[model samples]
Target: MSIAISTALQSSFADAVTRTREALAGQGFGVLTEIDMKATLKAKLDQDMENYLILGACNPPLAHRAVDIDRQIGLLLPCNVVVRTDPDDDTRVLVEAMNPQLLVQVTGDPALQEVADEVTAKLRAAIQALGPTSG
Candidate 1:
């Protein structure tokens, strides 16, 4: 299975990032952490890259359910969503979200399948909300 669900939007990098966060919130997810990859790479490695962001998103109830199913599931508690400029075309932005089903594979627990399916559905909805170009 694909590790992530992705889409391309014809929007400014900054606008795509903002819209993505809003979309996640509409689906009952909250941003728990934000990683500015461009800034990090420049500061730590002196490498310049496109505007890229990583939003650590979590739906509390789902997270709690998964954790209750398997304590070690915390390792994948928050789903990561990334927004970045298309290297070949700066006018377009790419957004990709983690696939929760991977949790079932990692934990070998059938119980997690439901939670994964639910989370995946929500994440997919959030991405689709971006518009016709979204996947």
Candidate 2:
């Protein structure tokens, strides 16, 4: 199975977050929501956890174009990216997204597939510019 692009980096938790948001925006994506996992877990379970943030990002034009081709593509809308702390207390972040090719299989729409492929590469470039290589 092909896992999503994940990576570790040496940066402050806040810096990682800011950089991620900036990079995503720079690449034409806008952050739709920010989920603070650590705060949520602590508030609900009274458990202390490392810093973790979830970012819901979307590119309006591309997304609209994709949905035009395959209305069901909404299932894959708003790509998710995460920022979390490592064991050593350093910050790391990862972006988990469905493979665009898989979306092609589901939608069976060539144009929609093209959009997914381009978005995937754009997201990859955004993450790589911010941290360690993801293999």
Clash count for each candidate, listed in order shown:
0, 0
Model 1 alpha-carbon drift over 4 Å, by segment: 133-135
Note the Cα lDDT for every prediction shown. 0.92, 0.75
Please provide, for model 1 over 1-135, each residue's C-alpha lDDT reduced to its tens digit, 9 standing for 90 to 100.
Answer: 888888999999888998999999999999999999999999999999999999999999999999999999998868999999988998889999998989999789999999999999999999999865343
TM-scores of all models? 0.96, 0.83
| Candidate 2 similarity to native, TM-score | 0.83
lDDT of 1: 0.92
Query: How far in Å is the alpha carbon of 82 misplaced in model 2?
Result: 0.6
Winning model by lDDT = 1
lDDT of 2 by residue, 60-96 (tens): 9888888888788888777788778884644444444
